[model samples]
Target: MSVTNQTTVTEFILLGFPGPSSLKLTLFVTFLAVYLLSFMGNTLIMFLILMDSTLQTPMYIFLGNLSFLEIWYTTATVPKLLATCLLETVTIPVSGCIAQYYFFFSLGATECILLAVMAYDRHVAVNRPLHYSVLMSIEICLRFSAGSWTGGFIAPLLPTILISHLNFCGPQKIDHFFCDSDPIFKLSCSDTFLAEALGYTCSSVVILTSFLVTMSSYGKIVVTIIKLSSREARKKTFSTCASHLTVVTIYYGTIIFAYVRPPAKYNFTIGKVISVFYCVVTPLVNPLIYTLRNKDVMKAFQKFLAQKRFLLTRNMHKF
Candidate 1:
């Protein structure tokens, strides 16, 4: 293959949501609010997991890792998107754009594996109740969590490196909020057949494999739940998995719609809307779902608040 002359594209102007000035401000404010809430929610989960001794189980440990991933995942792209909404023309340097794409996808891949690991954890908890503690010991949980992080970080490296080396001759305006692989690849002037092939191959392997594992774990969980004689037992068991199932459904649904297809068939507007759901909405809602549905989390939160109030009252009396 003959090498095309490398493009002089130094920066990419992000053509964020195209609309009236009022719409821009509205989007900016909306995204800013979402980002802030996502940040706070994830941070709170991490903090609670760290502070509450009762939450030192394998489930919460995995959750803490997930919260950490969510914080950085949203951080990778949301701020830049917010900036583009506010500024008339927001340009990211080529290197910065590449880095953003790499991290965004890497973090997302990490979440994918993490979710599957969470499913397996739940499966073992429900299926092997007698050996739950033994099966999911601290060391084992750490290994699973570490594997997710490592796999997530390494999964996109090859594709990202391949795409980065491709030539972008001109037309550096990306018609989306962030520097995603599809948008960036579209801008490349070089022959992108190999890059595209590699991307699809990697995505299929990561997404399909992780998704299958999660589904299989849930499948076994469903079978085990069915064997429970008491309605209450079954209901309680289902509740434990409910929040995770909801999150997995929303996350994988949006991701499958967005990336698991040929780029030629991609609808930019639809993709952007779905991207907002997974990228912006899911992270914000995850903690809410888990905390609200979880009795333990609620009890812990109330206890934390009560402790703070008691401390304040005592301090005031002393003063």
Candidate 2:
């Protein structure tokens, strides 16, 4: 149907995960478990950062913002995905799809910027330990956090607007689990050149810029760590950033592959598989990575548990 004659699509069918009917129950269970784990893990990180006085430093502040972002990040799509797995044929209104894309992109961009900020934080800590307190003060941390969020939210606005205005003439089925750029662009009948260009530009600027910043910071950090005479000093310094580096590797690797490609290179099947890593796995693993690797977080968690137990015991005695 020509764009001139056909009505714009008001809704889209999300062909969520091409799989056998027998796998739906497994997929639902798996996604549900992932969502819950991601939520609780990130929430615990936020809670520890808030309550633990020792974790009130600039590093943990960035971590807290990340955890908070992860909660909403996973929330924006996972629940809907869970619903889709259960319902079989999932249809979304145009507006809802747009909203989902905006939030998902915004949070993702925020994470990129935030991760760079964290790398810089570690740089200051390791290379300029004497000036760490002065360099990464509370005010500066808050400003960086606010700027990351603001830039993230603003970056996607124009592209999202462009995508939403495109006419979907027919075959309004999104072949991916969620409303991603490639799948959405593939479905549109309108001239998507401008939209695709804008999407690529925004994605490259956000991902590449942040990736460079993160790598540069880590590069400097590695040099400084190598300069340290004591092996213990070097090990300790690298430990601080190991988790973040892991997350950065996973996130940038997946996102760059997913978003920065030319339209011709899009493989929807592979795209969905890669999407699961960043979308479902990254958020779920972030808290685990940080906590399992960092002694400070473990100590805080133990302390918090001990305090809760003490209070529980005291209350029981009173009762």
**RMSD in Å for all candidates:** 1.5, 1.2
- lDDT values, one for every candidate: 0.89, 0.91
Candidate 1 per-residue lDDT over residues 137-228, each given as its tens digit: 99999999999999988998998898888877688899889987788888888788888888877877888899999999999999999999
Candidate 1 residue runs with Cα over 4 Å from true position: 1-7
lDDT of candidate 2 over 167-273, digit per residue (tens): 88787999888898888888888899999899889988999999999999999999999899999998988888999999999999999998877767988899888
Which candidate number would show the highest lDDT if scored against the true structure? 2
In model 1, the clashing pairs are none
TM-score of 2: 0.97
Assess every candidate by TM-score.
0.97, 0.97
> For all candidates, what are the clash counts?
0, 0
List residue ranges in candidate 2 displaced over 4 A: none
